[model samples]
Target: MRNYFIDLLTKEAESNNKIMLMVGDLGFSVVENFKEKYPKQFINAGVAEQNMTGMAAGLASEKFHVFTYSIANFNTFRCSEQIRNDIDYHNYNVTVVSVGGGLSYGALGYSHHAIQDYALMRSFPNMTIYAPGTRSEITNCMKQIFKSKSPAYLRLGKTLPKNFKKLYKPNHCAPGKWTKILECKNPDSRKCILTTGAVIDDAVQMQKKEEFSNYHIYSLPIWGMQYKTLQAKQINKWDEIVTLEDHLEDGGFGSYILECNSNIKTAGETKIKLKSLNKNVCNTVGDQDNLKEHFKFAH
Candidate 1:
């Protein structure tokens, strides 16, 4: 996923010099290709996340679409004030690229944990959250990011799926719209496992379990507070929705879905179940799979 992001960004930069990438001291080997190919459009902002975000806003004020890249917690929580005031407040074209989201960097401990990132990023009124589930969804999200002229948060995972190129379908993705990934044998099944971000892999795994075998699988890659009404409408079509995410339940993707239909009038008859990471795993240290198992994240 990291390699794909750099490859896609590098290609986009070729046609638009206004598209720039500013990174902290991290992303060394993963970002070298983009840095070497687009020297003029790249900046190494050292370890200061706040300053990097401010600089991104300044460049965005000049009509440039700048992306601030770094580890999930550093680029987000560490520089949240800058992101909220400098970029989001002014509606700058800055995309906060957070790699190693969730427990991807769990071995480094809580300092690297990004399970609470969505809670912070989604609170920004002008910000759009792009949590692509597949390589194809990543491409679709990049298109929407370039089309919009506002702040965005691009959450990326550390690893790619096995045989991903051949396994994923090349599908189109739209904001607030569910992209159907897998269909159950029952054509009229209204029950589905809906998810966003890399946790879509977990949804697939759950489908193989007895509890979710009859559910269709769907992924919503692009969404934000502004899409509530759209989400309610989509929610109305389903009889049951099981939302999954790697983040905590509070202010996470599942919570967002509930908020969309909170109003009695907007709240349909659909049964919505939220499956998110247990808070107990926040401070634990382990590899991605082990940390996830500590809380039974996929269950």
Candidate 2:
């Protein structure tokens, strides 16, 4: 995805000439290609994320297509106020490309995790949230953002699974009410597993262990599907609508489901069980799976 995103940006920057690439001092070798190709357009804003976001907004106000780049939390979480007040509030044409969306830096602990970006960004009025399932989808997402009139947010994974390329299309038809369901080996199963990101593969793995009766995995991009209708359907057909993701329980995809259902009352929660990777900063870690296991997100 990094290779694809960088190359895409480079080509666009060359053609547009008015685009600016601003970073919060995080992109090292990953963004070197862009920095080299368009030296004048690329600016390393050091570690001041808030200031970086503000500067991006100022640049956008000049009719420049401001492109802000950084790792998950540092780019989105740190400068949220700037993003809200300067960009979303003003409806500026700023494109924020967030890498390591979920747990790409799982070994780096909580400081690096971008668990709540989707929920936070979705609440802003003039923001368009996009989460692609593959590299091709990412390219489509870029083109999709270009057609929008408001601010844009693109959530991405640094290390994506192979299944995404074969099973997904990188395009933004819309954010909410946009869902794509892939057919599993079995079609009659009433079980519809709702999941996103690489963790969807985990649900598929669970299915191979024991063919879950009427169980089907649905890859729902961020803010995808109508939660009210989905809730009603899940209650009637399937006994479980498991939500799995590499994010915190609160302020993540699970909360998005809760936000949509205004009248749902299931013991202070929605029907979807909020399955998320723990958000606590850890002192011990080996890999992404180790972190999920230590946090008890294993299948």
Candidate 3:
């Protein structure tokens, strides 16, 4: 996904001279091609995410569509003040791209976990939050946001799926503003697996013929999904919901539903019981698969 963004952003910059990129001393080999190609547009601002964001806003205020890149916390949390004040506050045309969104750097421990990024970033008005599940979703999402003037947050996972080239239909959200239900089946069981990010994989598996054969699946990858509409959709579809995410419950997928901000969450809080499986930090060592299984995203 990082490679995909670098490629897409480079392409966008070539065609639209208004686009600019700033990095916080990260991206290593992933952003080399982009940096080499557009040296002027690409600024390696060292580890100062706050300064980088201010620079992005300065460029955006001048009508250049700017983007600030870094690890999730650096991009979204470390420089959040700049994001809120300079971009989101005035509705600047800036895109905040953060990698290692969940536990992408799991072996590196909790400091690398972007568990609270969503909560921190979403607090600002006019900010749109997106978590793309597939490689295709990443590029397509960038395309949509570049054309949009609203400030946006693009939450990308650290690793790409094995089938990186395959196109998975974006769960109705498709680079849109808020969450959308991707797929649903097995209505008789009345249980819904509500997921975001790559947990879509687990949710799909759960609804498989034998695993959770009787339950339904719903993907709300985008944050701030309007609750009223989501509620109406759920009422027309399933009964109960269990939020599945790779981040903490407070400010990620589960919290969105738990606070009644989600249509599904509201219904669950008011009518049906709500459950969540989330993590506040990297709870284990090994690869991504191990973490997923440990958290019950897979079994």
Better of 1 and 2 by TM-score: 1
Model 2 Cα displacement at 210 (Å)?
2.4
How accurate locally, in lDDT, is each candidate? 0.88, 0.69, 0.68
TM-scores of the models, in the order given:
0.96, 0.82, 0.83
Tell me how candidate 3 scores on lDDT.
0.68
| TM-score, cand. 3 | 0.83
**Any runs in candidate 1 off by more than 4 Å, and if so which?**
163-170, 264-268
Expressed as tens digits, the lDDT of each residue in 1-299 for candidate 2 is: 66677788888888888789898887777789889889999999998988989998999889888888888788788889998899999999998888887767777766777777777787787787667655555666677676665688877776555566445453443444434445556666555566655465566555555644345666655343323345443344445566677667776666665554444444333345667766563454446666666766735
Please provide, for model 3 over 82-198, each residue's C-alpha lDDT reduced to its tens digit, 9 standing for 90 to 100. Answer: 888988889998989888877776666666777777778668778877777766566557766877897888888877655434324553454323343334444356666666665
lDDT of 2 at 160: 57
Give the range of the ten consecutive residues with the poorest summed lDDT in model 2: 224-233
Q: Say which prediction, candidate 1 or candidate 3, comes out ahead on TM-score.
A: 1
Model 2 spans > 4 angstroms off? 165-173, 211-213, 222-240, 263-271, 279-284
Candidates arranged by lDDT, highest first: 1, 2, 3
Give candidate 1's error at residue 58 in angstroms: 0.7
Question: Could you say which candidate leads in TM-score?
Answer: 1
